[model samples]
Target: MKEYLDLCQRIINEGKWIKNKRTGVRCLTIINAEFEYNVRDNQFPIITTRKGFYKSAIAELLGYLRGYDNAAQFREIGCNTWNDNANKNQDWLNNPYRKDKDDMGRIYGIQGRSWQRPNGSKFDQLKKIINNLKRGIDDRAEIITFFNPGEIEMGCLRPCMHTHTFSLLGETLYLTSYQRSCDVPLGLNFNQIHCFVLLMLMARFTNYIPGKAYHKIVNAHIYENQLPLLCNIQLKRKPFQSPSLIINPKIKKLEDIETWVSVDDFIIQGYRHHGAIKYPFTI
Candidate 1:
């Protein structure tokens, strides 16, 4: 984690910030790394330094994972992370077409489905591979894909280019995800951590081998503007800590945990008043 913090600081001290329409205003650059790994726990991955941004990020990530494209469900849950980007003219409250609406071209269902193709090709392919594996099938054709070339015109966020390769070694299942681009300052750290969490959950529910996940970032790039923030973050004396977990006494089955994944609340409630801290460093 110190290494990660150092890298973030380097980017901020040396990188330049630029604005881009796709990611709103951003700072972009390339980051070369030798290794990357994943870790899992019952709670969502978020840094809890200076009031964490865990809630909104978790809500957004879950919303995407559960196939809920619109903000209705989020709003109902007292989470409005996606409202900032909604079409102003559209009445989000009464729109039945809300579900049909696409974010940049990605529909909620598209992401939820194991495969992107309509005839269930993705699931079909996965099943075929699974059956083959059970029957001693050792073919390279067992891969599942998420990107859809045809949907490019529909305005979806380009499918997460990262792909996961699943393999079974003895009784354990192993997965590796390849991400080409990562927005370090604004979102990369959390995204990488949460995506791994999702992958682990999927493997658990599907009864796949409970194994470690390997994340590989290809052409891994970082935004320049985020560098300063990243540097500032590293300069702080304390590293972020996970919130304490507590169980609900009334509901024996339910555990209550304060999530720190959302960035919206952190920005509004935490960062607004705190002045930036300075640390000695040189490019």
Candidate 2:
């Protein structure tokens, strides 16, 4: 947790000022920021300075596993993160490929679960990885990526936390998550949990002990509207020890994850934090 706070402080001290034309909000930005979580210790890496929403983050990951491309599907499973991007994004609304309200298009889980193939057959990137991991196989290509250049224009928003590569060494499972862009105040909190939980789940299903989660961010920034709240309040707060998460033991396979898994199935223990400090989010 100190690393996260340090990253924030680094942005305040060393970040460059940049104007974002898309959101029309200026940002204090840093590049090539990275952090690691020792998942082997079972410590959940979350923003201890604020009351982070655990269910919402977990639900978003679960939705991605199920290949959900609709914002309504995200909401039904305790995640509303996609609502604004799906409904309010002007470009997505104007796109002909957008199916209806709450449609997120060909992004995230859609691409992970059913990537378009050359032969017209869909490729299940996640399934292949899971199957390989279960059999103690590491092909050195266990990756499920959400960033698809071919389908970027068909989606509501470009993926921030884009690629997750799983690796197996003996009986330990490690994760490397790559993010192209990071909204430090709001997005990093969710993304930290995403990376930790993802590694934990993959380890659980593959019968391997969870190891470390390494998160790499290309562009980390704090929006102009979010600066005061982050600097004046959040950055000033003290962070508690990282918490721990417990998953349903019965969920031992990818089928359980694909068929029916909710945020209710997961629990976080010993989460201590100050009151929630709402941060600004850009569409």
Candidate 3:
């Protein structure tokens, strides 16, 4: 978890100010940051400095895995993380592609689950990856990507953590995720857990041992309003040890994950941390 703290300090120490019109706030921004999680040891990359929302983060990932494109669906699964972006973002609210209330247009899950094809058919990237990995086959291209530049204008928001690539070496599974932009103070906490759990779940269903989850960030930034709390309070506190994650073995297939998986199926062990530090989310 010291790596997480180091990132925060790095932003405070070395970041440059950049004006962002979307949130109407300046940001301390940097580029090309990286983090690697030791999934084989179950050393979960949860933020131990604050009361982390591991369940909610898992639930959000589940919604994407289920191909849910609506915020309401996420809420029904005990994840309210999308409510703000769905209904509150003025740009999305004004976009004509927005179907109705709670419509997330064709963002993360939609792109991952049913990436549109050029010939009028649909492609299931996740299904293909799962099936291939299950058979101990990694064609060196087991990728599920949600970065559709053609449909970017139609989605609620452009995909940030856009691509997830899986690799297999013998019986071990490894994952690498790439993101173009990040709201470090708020989003990174959840994303680390998301990637770690994604690798764990993929390993479980594919009969592969979890290896590691690598995360790459292109532009990492803390909004001006978020910098004070992150740099002054959260960074000042010491981080506890990384926690361990356990997932139910019942999730043996992609269908199992899409059909009946709940956040309750995942549990955290030995998660000791300081009190919660509430940070304002940038829309």
Predicted structure 2: lDDT: 0.91
lDDT of 2 by residue, 1-283 (tens): 7889899889999999999888888999989999999889988987788899988999999999999999999999999999999999898899999999999999999999999987879999998998899888998999999998988998888888999999888989999999999999898989999999999898988889999999999999999899999888888888898888889888888889888777889999999998998787788
How many Å off is the CA of 156 in candidate 2? 0.6
Measured by C-alpha RMSD in angstroms, how accurate is candidate 3? 0.9
Q: lDDT of each prediction vs. the true structure?
A: 0.45, 0.91, 0.90
- Sort by lDDT, best first: 2, 3, 1
lDDT by residue for model 3 over 1-283, one digit each (tens)? Answer: 8778888888888999999888888999998899999999999888887889899999999999989999999999989988988999999999999999999989899999999999878899998998998877899999999999999989888889999999999989999999999888888988898899999888888888999899999999999998778767888888788889888877787888878889899999999988888888888
Give one digit per residue, the lDDT tens place, for model 1 in 29-135. Answer: 54453234433333323443333344555555555544455556556444464454443323432344344433322443344344455764654334444455555
- Model 3 earns a TM-score of 0.98
> How accurate locally is residue 278 in candidate 1, as Cα lDDT from 0 to 100?
29
Worst 10 residues of 2 by lDDT: 253-262
**All candidates: TM-score:** 0.60, 0.98, 0.98
**Against the true structure, whose lDDT is highest?**
2
Lowest lDDT block of 10, candidate 3: 227-236
What's the lDDT for residue 112 in model 1? 36
